[model samples]
Target: MIASPDDVLDALDPEQRQVAEAVDGAVCVLAGAGTGKTRAITHRIAYGVLTGAMQPTQTLAVTFTARAAGEMRGRLRDLGVPGVQARTFHAAALRQLHYFWPKVFAGPPPQLVETKIALVRDAVQHCRLRADRTELRDITSEIEWSKATQTAPDDYPRALLEAGRKPPREAAEIAHVYAAYEKIKSGQGRMDFEDVLLLTIGLLDDRPEVREAVQAQYRHFTVDEYQDVNPLQQRLLDLWADRARSLCVVGDASQTIYSFTGATPAYLLGFRRRHPGARLVELVRDYRSTPQVVGLANRLLAHATGEAAKHRLELISQRGEGPDPRFVEHSDEQAEAESTAKQIRKLIDDGVRPAEIAVLFRTNSQSESYEQALADQSVAYLLKGAERFFERPEVRQAMGFLRAHAISSGSDPEPAHLPAEVRAVLGNTGWSAEPPAGSGQAREKWESVAALLRLAEEFAVKWPDATLRDFTVELAERANAQHAPTVEGVTLASLHAAKGLEWDAVFLVGLNEGMMPIAYADTAAKIEEERRLLYVGVTRAREHLTLSWALSRTPGGRGRNPSRFLDGLRGTGSARPDAFRSPGAGRGPDGTVRPRRKVGPVRCRVCAKALQDAAERKIGRCLDCPSDVDAYLFEQLHQWRLERATEHSQPAFVIFTDATLTAIAEVRPLNERQLAAIPGVSRTKLERFGDDVLALCAGHELAIESDPDEFEGVPEPEIVPDGA
Candidate 1:
């Protein structure tokens, strides 16, 4: 019983209805999270088709991912409208390229390269450079960024510098490698994924007939997640639309998290400026989370500072009151994982379905401990957005053959014979370079294997001396670094991947300072992005939300502080004294009284007075104590080290280990001459940080010391570790 298009408007709220009814001209919908934007857009398409405003075949609905496109098509079908041209930008471009390729020059367009990293590795080798797995990954990202931003190979270095991007490899070397990669790919008559768009654009520009055909076919267009539109995608979109202004785009600028891939919200944000007559609609009512969860999300947005913040639409919760969001603090990561699992179990017993819950983190790396904890508790779980196509079983098997041959070849390998070995491996696996006649899982697998062989050719050129063992090691490292396979159960995903998704209950685990804000987020802009990421995670919950963090990564390790994002939500600048209690302070599982460890306000070692400042308490010293010599200088040095580490994208310990800082504090070196003599103060470091270090020490020396009144009301001193 599919509903007719006329009745589709009934499904939308007033604001959504307004968006859905707009079927003509340029339209921009600034839809906030959980605002029923998907429903509105789908209904708009259905309505337009039913009312004869546009034929189903005349409309092109574009989304960011294949999954998203499938969802849109499904929703449109449910609304009694089908045959709409819904596809990803890449898919749409590829279709046009295929149709127009034979007319231009070639028998067939070069097959799309599926595994880009392998080809990039070949590119690096062609330039006679060696790169580890990490470096290779970085190079791949740089290449993607270069393509998305439309930077030419020769102009990449200057472009990267202008954009303030820091590539792992030298810019000039990357440019050379990119040039070599392009030549090889062209020589082989193949193109990578990005090349699909580049080729399509070129084909349309060079030949007007194809461009006219595409524009005539897709007379009306609608784009989802328009905020994430990259320049390349935008160019294709413009060519397809052909200034008809019949495009309806919907997105939230606040959710623009793909800037790393050159996606920008500028297109979405400046829709009116681009098309002055464009109609605008705003969606703010959140149909997802309860009032309490929405309130916290609003608070998160309140802290955001940027163009997104300026246009931010504070979500108005439509649901009734529910559970207050929980903030739990644990002693370490293991405890956090265990406690999260226990909560999930309790929720299941309380009648929440396992599928209704999700545990989101800032990074995929944080999923391992949670996966273990869930398994230990006999809980069924799933990992969404984790299984990459290249990491699939059949794909990995094909890559394995190439890796084995590469490792066995070692130094002085025969380049001409490598293709034969690759062919032999493919033959053994019942695969061929030509894809199966139709599209399905089997054809996709064959394409993946073909891509691997292409990578092998590149590798042969780059590392003729490399062995199969070396390739295998690199592949294993890559496999280890990849996210787990997606399965059906409780969901686990990174905060980024969790966007455009929702769950009845969400557990945002590992909310510590370094993990949430991530030490690399040194700039004010980067921190804002982190804050936006947290907001994205928060809004993903429809009912219950639990934010938890560990004091340390491991038991008996140095303590960690809660994320600063938790400050306003908790109504405190720091964690409350009772926020995190030791395991011994609470009752055991059997309800027996557990013995407690000594817990109270931390007192200074010299004066025995409760330390008021948290920093002072952590340092375990009173301001007037003799051991506090040059404490100010040490604090300044630590701050400087943190800033320097952020600039260099290194850990604070790497710049100046904690032990080195302590020694400096104790010695209070007054000059570069003395600073150079200190252990851990390498000559290079002295040249870099010596002036600032000595100046701070001199400033501290000018401060009045040895206050006689400091000991007036103090008890006998207790021995404690320096800076405890």
Candidate 2:
């Protein structure tokens, strides 16, 4: 009555067709980037539904990211398979946990505790942990593992030791702090993300009712990026697969880069041996990248060591010949950033969209100089996986104030109360956000408060008789407390966070040593992992990819070397990569010679911290010059400035910034009170620094308080003190 499954073969290429049509047994599609593996899976789901072999609700499709899930959903809908369930592993698990938690527990489920580095910091302080200035992220990762594997704090040291996770050689102290952390978390009544999956797996394993229900519900299961299934996710997937033979999967062992999160390709490699009758499919078509890029990818794979290199699948380049991959060397960070930005500008001038170009880096910290260089060049860019968005100074302050007020007033019965007050105050002061969109978990409780407030405004507009108090009262009642905004624009993601994502144009910036392979990659294994990370970044670009590294830190910090990966490619002048070096780079537009600038070290005048190469001089007397140039911005920015050519006295930015001085010269705040009212001028500082600021605003010379620190190394700052 229905055509054979081979009918689906019409849309896929030979390799893809086989993988897509192999519905009778376990299927494994091992392929390289752009080989249409994702497309084949999507089509296979569509065909199964169309052939009446699989119901939309019975099959499970998994992706690695929320973005990928959305994309898969759209693709399935386009192919007339709307009901197929497609989601990220974590997202799906969280959903199931929320649904089943109450039913199984017989009462309201224990709330997920939101773990923070604050807990680690408290531990560090409480336990007097004097680590070598370890970062919050590293600590968080350790805690993440402890919870993911369901190890109680009492058992963590033994469990982590067994799991090969080394930290703080002092187990007793770590145990003490970990115990304190648990006590604190129990008081808070929330759980970190890993615990959610672990809990889900527990419920499934401990309760047959829940396990059988889920197993029966998901008749078939498909997982993408199978190499990255963490232990908890693997456990859940195993349960689902226990009763159903319809487990189809796709992944390349070479792309297994998340070992830190406890994800390994061992399951993928062991798939066929474990399931003897599995229908294994291998697709080698390199459909996404040009031959040159593919060649480089292949070379890297060939050079790769360890498990991934050993299991590397051959990539058959199917795309046409493209530009060569380039290697650019820099003497320092500044030169590298400037050089890269200049090249991007040239590409833009030649009709490349800014969005089509991306600059990737090995870590988030590396983005600073490149972000500055791009900012210097007026290039708009997006950062990925950074808590930076939430860390905005203003947002932090507002949230802090709201959270404080909420705690004082009591957050129960409404977490929305304080945030609403803060937002109302901010909006009145000219912040125009209308809350985040979507019905995500956060929106359910708090974020919708803003939305409700918005609706209240609309209702008021329709019913003009309603007053502000009326709307405010109604808004509070409907307030949904915790909404994370649906942020848009370009993404600036970390190399690890950038996994499973594709972009039009990508920039991999900050390829410097200590940042890329990072300082710890001194080990052979870590170094190889770093190489795989770079390969991962390279593969993310659909059209354009820019890889760059800086030789030194920009003036404020100690200098670092250009990443070892970029060492040999360093040219003498301008440091432009030669043709055949990279597919996205290489030749400049219009056949013009891209200058290769030789880089030299430039040390900061203040702390002696190096700022890129010597040729990249400070922007007209170190923007950070400690000279009391009250008229200038970023007072501390002029740390290591040298060779001052002018004598102009004014207070530092605290006394009055150059921009404020310019505004003062233009708008001219005439008196003490008026100066106090100006933005950034605190009442205490305005009273104390009043005469000095007022005199400058009125274009008059005035005396200022002297500081011992102002002229630390130099005795000549008296030549022209700022706001004097």
Candidate 3:
């Protein structure tokens, strides 16, 4: 039996009780992260059914994703309220379209295309334009955005300018592609996911009978994730509640991360203006995370600007205190990944299940190193909301496409525009110099193509005459070697994919300046959205949270700074001497630290000029300085380092970072005193390799081979927890 109104109301928090009690007319629930919005809304529906205010069959609950809709249905069932319809906007609209198609104009509903990729690809071919897989996805997204906003193909260009949309391609080009896509879709007697919503709206608008039936059938309406409702969804909702505006919407503008999909928080924010008597309730009591996590989330939003942040709710944690979020700075991307994997292993060993942990990043491209690092540590991991790089359809297709082009070229001399030629060949699959402007699948696809292009560039640089055929072979080898995703393991996901989900622990990796706010987050509005994105990541953790960034992308690359969003968040203290816990942290021999000292900018030892590059800082010299590096000594050190790395089964850089190796070669350390003076040559490393290194510098070889087992019993570095 359904719970009574009093019984339902008694179970809700004060604000949630207000949300459940205001069961008539229009209502708006300003729910913050971790708040019990789901509980409040489900109880409201049950209370209404129990009090004879609404019928079960007539109530409809709509959300963004199928998983969310299913969750809502499950929650409603647990509340003793069954028979109420719960579905995603697409599912509900598709069902209504099928039911009303015969009544309106068609013999039967047009066959719905499962995905827009094929159709969009066909449209690109029809328009005689070149697009790679990424471009095709971007075009598909643009069409969806256009249809959701009710903008016609002819007006897409103006719409883009008006809305400040930076599409992957030119607005005019996208419009042509959009127009061609519609024509082809119509010619094949097929409709897309977006068309389902558009056609349903058309049926309701054109046929009053159909509109009345739907409106009368669904009298009480509730919307979840209302902040993510696009114009098309709002139109459908309006049609469903035409005369009787018995509606309830739950959303947090702070969680609005789908603007790329044309979703807007305007409707949720303006609900009071639309319905003057709408009951407004603010659910600030967060039931998911502890006070520490909640406080960080609130602080993240406090720095946010723009309209969405204007109405941000300050979440109060209902749970007890938890560990403060930690921030770690690493030497490079590889170090960051390894450190993250080690921590995940520690968490699992400490009783946290693998599935209870997640590692989130800004882009899918960053997942590779983490995947490798986790595997290296023997920790299982699953890719959430993404596919393994090699297994992606776009990547597989591009490989085939490139191989075909390479065969067709057949013995031609190297073209001067090798990079351009490679781009042209991949353009058929959507390769471009610039990346996609939007997030999600389009961005992920673009990153994949960009990686291929980067490989081609590197190959061309290495062998000036290397042909397309050679590059294809290299790619095949990589694809064959790429690891398959794990079935059940630690979750690796993009921040966008982590929404509506929580974990016992979360590691937010790759928080560098160009990434978190993203390099293309040019405008103030977009930057604010990036801040909100970080906020979303922060709130996903229920207990343990660690945020980290690397100083460089590769072993030998120049330094990169942490994200500005973390300016006031990370700890500022003297560097720790520990090296084993995190390999390249602090002023130890293994890595350099950004210490708080009275020293001026590092100067070149030779020129006495200020040195800016990280590599130069490590060597204490400018790049243009006269040659002090011994070529033979450097080669010997490199060989020795490689052998050590092989013996240890670790990356060469892990044994000695590129900068450290270069510094050693330049200094040509003769003994313990000289070797100890070099940066990145830790005491432990001196004890381990000092004698061998000195002998090599003194032109002696093939002596004193040490066993790898001799290095056993060395303590691993502890993952230092940080506080602001």
The candidate scoring highest on lDDT is: 3
TM-score of 1: 0.67
**Candidate with best TM-score:** 3
User: Model 2 TM-score?
Assistant: 0.63
What order do candidates take by lDDT, descending? 3, 1, 2
Ranking of predictions according to TM-score: 3, 1, 2
**For residues 121-201, what per-residue lDDT tens digits would candidate 3 score against the true structure?**
988998899987666777888899999898999999999888878877788889999999999999999998888888998
All candidates: CA RMSD (Å)? 21.3, 17.9, 10.9
* Model 2 spans > 4 angstroms off: 1-8, 115-137, 150-155, 158-171, 183-190, 387-492, 503-513, 543-724
Error at 319, model 1, angstroms:
1.1
* TM-score of structure candidate 3: 0.74
- Please, what are the lDDT tens digits per residue for candidate 1 over residues 107-178? 789988997777878888989998765466667777888899999999998987677665665789989888
Error of 1 at 577 (Å): 11
- Model 2: which ten-residue window has the lowest total lDDT? 640-649
lDDT (Cα, 0-100) at 91 in candidate 2: 83
Query: After superposition on all CA atoms, how large is the RMSD of candidate 1?
Result: 21.3
